[model samples]
Target: MIISTRRIKQWLTFLILFVLFTLLLYQVMSFFTDMFEPDSIYKEPIGDAVKVFSDYGRQTSQATFSELVRERLLWFYEIGE
Candidate 1:
């Protein structure tokens, strides 16, 4: 069986349009779904994610953040009280 050029063109056009329509529908549905999503729709107000470090940035000998650095420094110093 032989297919006509016009018929083939029409089928090609239909296939292209069908694929495009499916993609567009998918995008629209995704947009609406995102708009209505419980978590994404209503979120807490934007705020800084990092909390300020306590102790006012003062490095103490026993400070957790400075503990390793203090230990290294102590290794070089004489064991003096």
Candidate 2:
């Protein structure tokens, strides 16, 4: 059996391009899927922290930056426990 060099090169090129295309497609799909889906970690604790800060700020007339940070850290620690 005789295989032409040109034919071998063509097959190699096709295989490489196919693999690259598949990887690119996978990355694009993953990016879109993740973009559409909301992450719970941020949605839950972060959102709750924002609300707590807002309410606390209103009640105390103003919450210091350090106080807000402390509150958020405490909230996270309590959640972990």
lDDT values, one for every candidate: 0.76, 0.80
Candidate 2, superposed: residue stretches over 4 Å from native: 41-81
Q: Per-candidate RMSD vs. true structure?
A: 10.8, 7.4
Error in Å for residue 71 of model 1 = 60
lDDT, candidate 2, 26-53, per-residue tens: 9999999999986675645633354433
lDDT of 2 at 41: 54
Candidate achieving the largest TM-score: 2
The TM-score that candidate 2 achieves is: 0.49
lDDT score, candidate 1, position 66: 60
Q: Write the per-residue lDDT of candidate 1 for residues 1-81, one digit (tens) a residue.
A: 997999999999999999999999999999998888787545555777554334535765555756755765686586652
